[model samples]
Target: MSGIPDNLVGLHKHVKQFREKNDETLFEELELFIEEEKVRRKLVLERPGELFFFYKEDYIVVTEELSKIPLTAEEFTGSSSLLRQLNEDQIDMVGQLTKELVILRSMRMWGSYLSC
Candidate 1:
């Protein structure tokens, strides 16, 4: 999915408004924006009346007729530890790929010398 939904386009405008209005109630203002997005999701998503719920079974379940309300903050929060680990892994892989490419190029050069 895209980074941000189209309905949230007004968020930028709101930010501008907040700046103009000198509103220090940042959390409350942002909460309103989040609620608006949630309502938008209800309108745009299928089975508008339904919601996903986590049960004692250690698995999440989605049911009809709004079994539970989902918390967007909890669901959307990123694990800093997980993200850092992933970035470290990616750096290691890129280093290995670079080393392999250098070795392959050197091997080709060595073979060319031997064939001369």
Candidate 2:
């Protein structure tokens, strides 16, 4: 039936190709981490530095907030070089952390207002 994810191909909703490189790719990846109603799964979020996220739910919230910003190599290249090799899952986790850092670093002057 609906077991295979690729089987969703017949649906009318727009399907995006990864090649175009747009918000859809980010949203699609974000959607994969969120579980609703009948389908629940574990989410794993990683720490790139001093930040700490105790629960998996943090990934859903963090990813949504982080996606609002775009990626830049000038900000990420240094920190990302911490690892020489990353498997797919590690790449995702590290990328998420890097994005989070970029946003927070960019918002640094906002100070305590970040909580608001």
Candidate 3:
């Protein structure tokens, strides 16, 4: 009842090779993390330092490493020491604080006009 070709002897060989050679647990964990990241980005406007995001007024600059900007998830995960410096949570907090600074700057600008 199987739909695979009867003559295909090596069809599953590659899969077995991959499973045997690769760290399946780590791969699965990374896969799940990727899925969660996708969902989080979909539900939210921003994803912290994952992207080149920042508030302009505070002169905040948030950008990923040049090498990682173009890499796929598989490539990023495979490479060691590629993204050791960037902290998503810390970057997100900095971005938020920058936005607040921008708001404060605009308020001061208008407040001066009202006072005059």
Candidate 4:
């Protein structure tokens, strides 16, 4: 997780290959990494229920409701809008951020399987 994003892609490819080859050592290593990642994520995402500013259920509900809201140009910058304003470097950075976010969401959804 401390490495550059490109390094992460390489690590992912390596891990995928290890799984394809049915390597037990790789499985153990990956399980350890997953456990460490779970603890790290829990530390960041978990908070006291009494913390009014950071209620987990409220955040989830808010995001769900927000997703249903229709986007307008004045209120939001959609992908098409971004394409017109972003420089090549900015676009690249945005793409990288989007990729990272997708990976994070997928990991969050399937983390239980990773531990097994």
Candidate 5:
């Protein structure tokens, strides 16, 4: 029942690669770094492959007539007005979880923590 962002796997790999490539130098591909970051954010904003804000519909029941059952964005695009409402902290929360999951995966200790 855990909620892992659909783009999390890519974020994990991207961050890991970015770390490995960083040389801590003045000319350390700053533009490339920025582009990578934008790509990461775009994944969330655009929600390619139905990314982020994961949910399960079968678990819910329609007790009565209502409007919004399963929540959804007004649009799924890099320039989505609704998706853009997510604040920096909210985005960072997912990023941080992705980082931690990456660490756990690297440790190969999934014997009990998680199944997926």
Candidate 6:
């Protein structure tokens, strides 16, 4: 009944082994894996320092006017040691703030044109 492929006998065996060793069901491990993946994906975009809009940006009319310039991870003001100290959620929040700052900077450059 599970979505795991029938052909993946090795995978099934591994799951069984893990279950027996840990006394945790395969479904429980799968759920934990999925949750961890979700957090990982949310914390870091496709590329380091990349900005992706997960939802519609209704608050800003010129939402589509994002800077095409790519930002490097090294460009972030946060030091690597300091960044390492933050949790996944905090890292995500930092990424969001970095994206917003870039957008705001771009808007300032074109504010006069949009005002008309």
Q: Point to the candidate with the largest lDDT.
A: 6
For all predictions, the C-alpha RMSD in Å is 21.3, 15.9, 21.0, 13.5, 16.1, 15.6
> Which wins on TM-score, candidate 1 or candidate 5?
5
Q: What do the candidate models score in CA lDDT, each in turn?
A: 0.39, 0.38, 0.38, 0.40, 0.35, 0.41
When summed lDDT is taken over every stretch of 10 residues in candidate 4, the lowest stretch is 50-59
Name the lDDT of candidate 3: 0.38
Which candidate has the top score in TM-score? 6
How does model 2 score by TM-score? 0.20
Tell me which residue pairs clash in candidate 2: none
Q: Taking the tens digit of each residue's C-alpha lDDT, what string does model 2 give over 1-116?
A: 12235644443355455344555565575465444312322322233333332222332234444443433444346434332232222543433544233244345442432342
lDDT of 6 by residue, 1-116 (tens): 12235564456555533645454465576676566556546555545554443221222212222433223345445344433433332543333333333343354433432232
lDDT per residue, candidate 1, 1-116, as tens digits? 12245665445465653673444465465666566556545544755544333111122224532233232334324444433443455532212222122233355433432231
Ranking by TM-score: 6, 4, 5, 3, 1, 2
TM-score for each of the candidates: 0.21, 0.20, 0.22, 0.25, 0.23, 0.25
Alpha carbon deviation, residue 50, candidate 6 (Å): 9.0
lDDT of 1 at 99: 18
Instruction: Rate residue 61 of model 2 by lDDT.
Output: 38
- Pairs of residues clashing in candidate 5: none
Segments of candidate 6 deviating more than 4 angstroms: 1-10, 14-24, 50-116
> Between candidates 3 and 5, which one is better according to TM-score?
5
Shift in Å, residue 112, candidate 5? 18
The residue-level lDDT of candidate 4 at 33 comes to: 60
Give the alpha carbon lDDT tens digit for every residue of 1-116 in model 3: 02125564554464654564355564575566556555544533455544332222112334445323433334456323222222322322222332223344455333432221
Alpha carbon deviation, residue 106, candidate 4 (Å): 7.0
